[model samples]
Target: MQRVRVLVIDDSALVRKLLSTMLACDPAIEVVGVAADPLIAREKIKQLEPDVLTLDVEMPRMDGLTFLENLMRLRPMPVVMVSSLTQQGAEVTLRALELGAVDFFTKPSNDLASTFAAGAQEICAKVKLAALTRPRVRTIVRKLEVAPRLSADAVLPRAQTPDSRGGSRIIAIGASTGGTEAIRVVLEAMPPDAPPILITQHIPAAFSGPFAARMDNCSAMRVCEARDGQPIQHGHAYIAPGSQHLLAMWDGARYVCRLHDGPPVNRHKPSVDVLFRSVAATVGAPAIGALLTGMGDDGARGLAEMREGGAMTLVQDEASSVVWGMPGAAWKLGAASEMLPLDHIAARLLELARQPIARAMRAVT
Candidate 1:
């Protein structure tokens, strides 16, 4: 098996060393070269021909974003961002995703070496995942072995019967890795008075609020990080807080958001499985579930449950996904009623939103 060759670019010597060390810890990743700035990295990229790149947000000579824009326009390949955990960092990282980065991870504010060491597994995994993305150097498909993890049951129990309590239709969406940009594309295309959207995208606690704010700027609908016990309203999109699990619950008379402080389901705090299962139980046939571009199979099982409960389900097609793991898993499990490209999902969802739940259920059945 050919290992994933990587180029590490950072202004900080310590960071460059730390990143290289962490990546080397994985047998599947080979640190081919390191660069102190984008200029040096540019030449190294041509020389080493690395399969993936770990780029720093702040750099000398040229900023990471500028270099990324140039690289993507000229020679596109998978790039993973290494950023700080500050508010500014979160904003910049989101921009990097929009600029076509496959994924990102924040460096520790203090105790850099120890912290980087502790996150070695995650760093290596992200690099390997990036290697599998578009403009690939080679085709490398390997199933990563993950430790046993808790399911949606750890947060919310599966309903014996679909709740069927809500009067209006609801939309549930989940994604990770390449999801931020994909979600932005879908939400930006939605009409102002579209059905309420509930989203779970795997992200750090510091980034979710900024991500929501960014989405709100471009999307016609009001998009915001969800608040506990908030009323679910039409023309609004609610994103799960990075630190808590956001669940859609029918509060006797109306649907509301309930935030849970449960253990990480599927190794994620704001897990897609938890949100999807909650929607399946509380909204039932009136809900529409879509699983977008992401790494891992976090939402696949929950989407299947949504289908069984009579909800219309959709998965993003592989050709349009940055990483097809989540949506592909759903496709393989026969969870999605239809698999569509990223550009067409919003229109299709709006079409379904206009139909009566009973008729939509009949169509899917």
Candidate 2:
């Protein structure tokens, strides 16, 4: 088998070295070349002509975003943004994905080990998967001025909402790819006083903060990145940070979040599986498990586990999924008690919040 060839592009020599060496350790990946910035990378593209490019968010001579914009216009290839762990970094990484890069992984600044420890396998696998995709021709795609929203086909409205007359039940959401748009619909449908929501989106650590802020500004729900020891509350939403796993723990009657720098699950630091499993144990049947659009089978198995544990499970149907990987997997497992479109996820959860059976089961469990 031909090893997946990769081009490492960064302004920092140390980062170039670290990234190349780490990727090289994988038997299926080979470091084709390393460039200190986009200028060199542009030249390497013509010379080495690697299968994939690992792009840095910021670079000298030309930044990764501008270069990526040009790359997609001229010759499209799969690119993954390597981002710093900052709000600014988060914004750029999200922009890169919108601009045509594949999925991103966070690179911890203070500790090199943490960056490589969790995402090593995923990095290699993504590079290979990306290489197999049809490469785009160099044509100036008018940058989408606005992120695409899910069409009605993408969402199925389940029930009318505002279950603000609530109990302690909260919402747990997991999504990938088209999730940004899918989430927008669900959150928009939610009432301001809706139950507390916990979300795990497969995004880089650098991007979760801004992503949450973006959602907060757009939706009725107040969204923020989850912090350790933060008590689970009503009327607010917490998103799992990119570089850590967000799990829930029950202290007597109250639930607080615990953040751990553990090895990645399903090749993601803040894996949906980890969060769903934690909710299944902590909130039991009270929480609603929603599997949204995304690539791969990351959250499918875990959502299924949640359903078996007696949670009301909702899977977005294939018509609504951009990739149909995660939600489809859950459906195949027979986990989803209700299969709906992306638009309807919020209404269904609201109805669940109204059900005494949901909270009653949790209290007993």
Candidate 3:
């Protein structure tokens, strides 16, 4: 098997060694070199041209953010961040994800082994997936001027409703990088009565509240941050919180949101995988899944699992994706039942939702 080349960048000698050793333990991963900071890492990147980089969030002379911004802007490469596990760490990690890092890990706590043990499968899985992801292409994003299609007029806790249309179908949306705007375009086209939407978007902790607030104002659907114990209802939209993995549960008669801080699902908290898999298990053939543009294959396998469970699945086509990694990965694996352009996504979803669920929808059943 060909090894995935990785360069470890950190100021701490112990961390550099720890990550290198742990990552190298995977037969498929190779530590090309270790650098104390970005300055040295840059020179090594030029030399080794490694397949991936594991970066520490804090460093001397130049902080990780400055270095990461330059890395993505100048020579785009897949970067997995290693961050401290503090409140600030979570905040910075989210910023790193927005700035184009493929994924992240918390600086292992003192009970490092237990922490690693809890999330090793996740870390390794994400790193492997990151290796196959496409490099990011820089684009200038302009602020939106028009209102969203699904914004709610009044607050009803999580009871807020959009259009009264009922779908025999449910839709699961997974998006990251540039997802906000992409989702807006999709939601705007939908009728007030749309399918119950459960979205897992990669967002920073500080930004999620603001993001949900922004979405609620623009879109006709009642948008709110996912809360543990909250019930999922039609006409309501759930946005996964920044630091928690949002998983759906079949609570007897209704679906409820569950918050988790267990290992990073596909290198992300509130991972698309957790949401996709849960939906796959809950609704089975009655679900319509859409994997939008993002930085990696986080949702691919989970969506594939959903498809296996007889759910209709769509992946965003490349032309419209800011970074086509997530959708492309799903496409390459034949996981997507349909490949739809971003412009057509909302309508396509509505069309699919309007259709009656059939045993034909049960690919796995």
User: Candidate 1's error at 24, in angstroms?
Assistant: 2.0
* Candidate order, lDDT descending: 1, 3, 2
Give a tens-digit lDDT track for model 1, residues 1-365: 99999999999999999999999989999999999999999999999999999999889899999999898889999999999999999999998998888889788899998999999998899999899988422111222223344568889998775454655799999999789988988888887778899999999899999999999998879999999999999889999999999999978767999999999998999999999999999888889999999888999999998988888899999988988999999999999999998888888888888787777556445
> Roughly what TM-score does model 2 have, to 2 decimal places?
0.63
The TM-score of predicted model 1 comes to 0.90
The predicted structure with the larger TM-score, 1 or 3, is: 1
User: Each prediction's Cα lDDT score?
Assistant: 0.90, 0.77, 0.78
Lowest summed lDDT across 10 adjacent residues in model 3 is found at 159-168
Q: Which has the higher TM-score value, candidate number 1 or candidate number 2?
A: 1
Residue 19 shift from truth in candidate 3, angstroms = 1.3
- Model 1 lDDT, full chain set: 0.90
Which stretches in model 2 have alpha-carbon errors above 4 Å? 1-8, 11-51, 69-77, 85-91, 98-100, 105-122, 132-168, 175-191, 201-211, 228-234, 241-271, 281-286, 293-301, 316-328, 338-365
Q: Estimate each model's TM-score.
A: 0.90, 0.63, 0.62
Cα lDDT tens digits, model 3, 76-137, are 98888888767677667766765777777777658765666666666666677678766554
Q: What is the lDDT of candidate 2?
A: 0.77
